[model samples]
Target chain A: MTWAAVLLLAAGTYALRLAGPMLRRRITLPEAAVRYCGLGAVVLLAAFIATSTMIDGTRLVGPTRPAAVAVGAILALRRAPFIVVVCGAAVTAAVLRLAGLP
Target chain B: MRLIRRTVVLVRGAGLLRDVIAVASAVGVVGASFGAMAAAAGVAPELTIGMSLLVFAGGAQFLAVGVIGAGGGIAAAILAGLLLNARHLPFGLAVGAAFDRGWATRIVGSHLMIDESVAFALAQREPERRRRAYWMCGIAVFVCWNLGTALGVLAGGAVGDPNVLGLDAAFPAGLLALLLPSLADRVALRVALIGATIAVVATPLLQPGAGLLLALIALAFALPLPARRPGRRP
Candidate 1:
């Protein structure tokens, strides 16, 4: 199942990437459609982030994870480098968990 | 032909090459994190490495692995990955000119069409520079990302528990970081907030992937309303 998913995703993503270059002359996406597609991607990602940070296997996790993620989000907003944001989150979570916040 | 000749001469400088390397190295760090997180979540190293090589989209790959690691069904993982990569359609359009030379180049270049490469390509004013930047960034990122993933898999094997090190938090954090730039747009921000709220609310009530999938409803809010009737009152 995992293999199937991976392969399917690979094929699908490749097609999307190729579509514009290959089909640009044949068809053009409406401006509104294009904007919506970008918006939809952001929505999906936001939902994923919320779920992952706040839930664990259908159960709500302690506040520590969310707090750590908040730290990461703040850094990201400030244009901190990727590594810094990641490390900041990890360190925050680790320290919080260690301090018995979990 | 003249442009090609000029491109060859311009390529002699190491300035762009250095810039590409810097960007690739930064991307490599994220790639390593993805590999490590996937392995720690019990994903096979082969699959982790395969994703880095094939998917080549950092955000989608991470989301797919995260979904699967959370026991979300394979179908859900695929769906999420596809949804996250939908932006590539516009990306392909924006940089399509860089890959128009030949069928082989087009096919290979399409596979390498990623956010960073497209951004780099678009930043250049000249057509030749755009093509060069696209290929250089794409190729560099591909190599560095794969190498980082391999190294990460090795390191992940040695780590005892991801949660203890707070590595579990890193996944969501990385994801949020990626999503931040998109949120800068007001409409996108509203949509994301609604979508996230729906997902969080529905999570415990639905199956593993269902909640996240449900978030698609939020996109309805983003749709352009029917052309306002010409005579409609304000």
Candidate 2:
């Protein structure tokens, strides 16, 4: 089941990637559609970050996870490199979790 | 004179070369964490490696595994992963013009069009240099990322409790880092904020992945009607 899901996602993603090259000439997007695409990118990314940090399946994670995510977010907004941002956030969460903050 | 000209060309491309290495190493480390987390979540080591190899998008893969590991359905995991990757359409479009002619190259190039490669390619102003950076960074990231995932799978069992090390936090942090640059645009910032609000609100009411999908509806506000021409009768 997991493998099938992975494969379906991969295939769909690849088609979307390929659509730009193969379909650009064949189909020109409407002005509104293009704008939506641009905005959709930002919105979807934001949604991903929120969902991953705040939601665990159907349940919400405890404050520690969200707090650690905030640390990462601040660093990221300040333009920290990928490694520092990821590790810094991880360490914050680890420390909090170690302290038994649920 | 010829040698000096060759040296100059090399010097010009050096920044992108350095950037490729930096991106590779950075992504590689995250890839390792992803493997460790997946393994810790009880996903088999082989499947973890396979996910890295096939999906190749770090954020989407992490989201998928997070959902699946949390006992979410497979369809939910797939939907979340695809939604996270929807940005690749624009990314591929941005860099599509940089590809050389040939079905083999195009197919392979399109397959490798992840965030790093697309960003590195578009950062270059010159077409030739952009293509070079694209291929260089694309191949470098692919190899390094997969290798890192394999290593992480091998070490995953030993790294018990991925959350203890805050690996869970790493997923959101990495995503935020990617979103940081785009947020500088006021429109993007507004859209993101609105989307985040929707996701937060919907999380409790809707299913796990549905909240994120609901956020895409925020893009409706970004749509604009075509402007009229100067002499239009309307």
Candidate 3:
């Protein structure tokens, strides 16, 4: 099942990546559609971040993870390097958990 | 005049290579986290590495692993990944000229069409410089990212439960970082907020990946309203 998912995703994503270049002269996407596609990606990513950070399966993982993620978000907004943002979140979560924050 | 221009481009290319390496290193770090998180989530080492090798899109790979790890079905995982990667369509268009050499280059270049590589390519004004930036960044990132993932998978095996060290938090954190830049646009921010709210609210009620799918409803808000009623007077 996992292999199938990976293969499908790989194929589909590659197609999308290839579509624009391959069809550039053959077709032109509507301006609105293009803009929406960009916006849609942002929406999906935000949604994913929220659910993954706050909920695990059907249960809320509690505040520790969210708090750590918050730190990472702030660092990212400030344009911190990717490594710092990641390590900062991990460290914050580990420290909070160590202090019994759950 | 042509020879002088070529010399200048070559000189600039040297500096661009340095910048591309720095960006590639950052991508490598995130790639490592992805490998470790996926492995810790009980993904087979081979599968984790395979996804990194083949999929190569950090956001999509991370989303797929997260969905599957939460017990979502394979269909949901693939769907989520495809949705996250939708941006690559425009990306390919914007950088198409970089791959104009031939079909062979196009196939491999499409596979290398990542956010950072495209960004680096677009930043250059000259077509020659742009092509150089694209290939240099793409190859550098590919090599570093794969190496990093391999190292991370090995490290993940040595480590015990990922949660103890908060490695689990790293996935969401990395995702949040990715989303941050896009949030700068006002409409995108509003849509993101709405989408996030829907996902959070629907999470408990719906199955794991279903809630994330439901968030697509937020795009309705992003769509432009119909034609301003055929140009009525303001």
CA lDDT of each candidate?
A: 0.77, 0.75, 0.77
Write the residue-wise lDDT of candidate 3 on A1-61 in tens digits: 3677778899999999888788764677785665665566566667777887998766889
Model 2 chain B lDDT-worst window of ten: B221-230
| Candidate 3 residue lDDT tens string, B89-153 | 75676678776577888889999988667655655557887788789989999988888788788
Q: Rank the candidates by lDDT, best first.
A: 1, 3, 2
iRMSD, all candidates: 5.1, 3.9, 4.8
Individual DockQ of the candidates? Answer: 0.47, 0.50, 0.48
| Residue-by-residue lDDT tens digits, candidate 1, A6-82 | 78999999999888778765677786665665566567667877887999857999999999999998998888876
Candidate 3 versus the native: TM-score? 0.62
Q: Which candidate, 1 or 2, would have the higher DockQ against the true structure?
A: 2
Model 2 Cα lDDT, one tens digit per residue, A1-102: 367777798898888778777765567877555555556756766876787788875588899999999998888777776677878898999999989997
User: By DockQ thresholds, what CAPRI class is model 2?
Assistant: medium
Could you tell me which 10 consecutive residues in candidate 3 chain B have the lowest summed lDDT? B222-231
Candidate 3 Cα outliers beyond 4 Å, as residue runs: A1-9, A16-25, A57-59, A75-87, B1-48, B57-106, B112-141, B152-156, B160-181, B203-210, B223-234
- TM-score (chain B) for candidate 1 is 0.65
Clash totals for all models, in order?
0, 0, 0
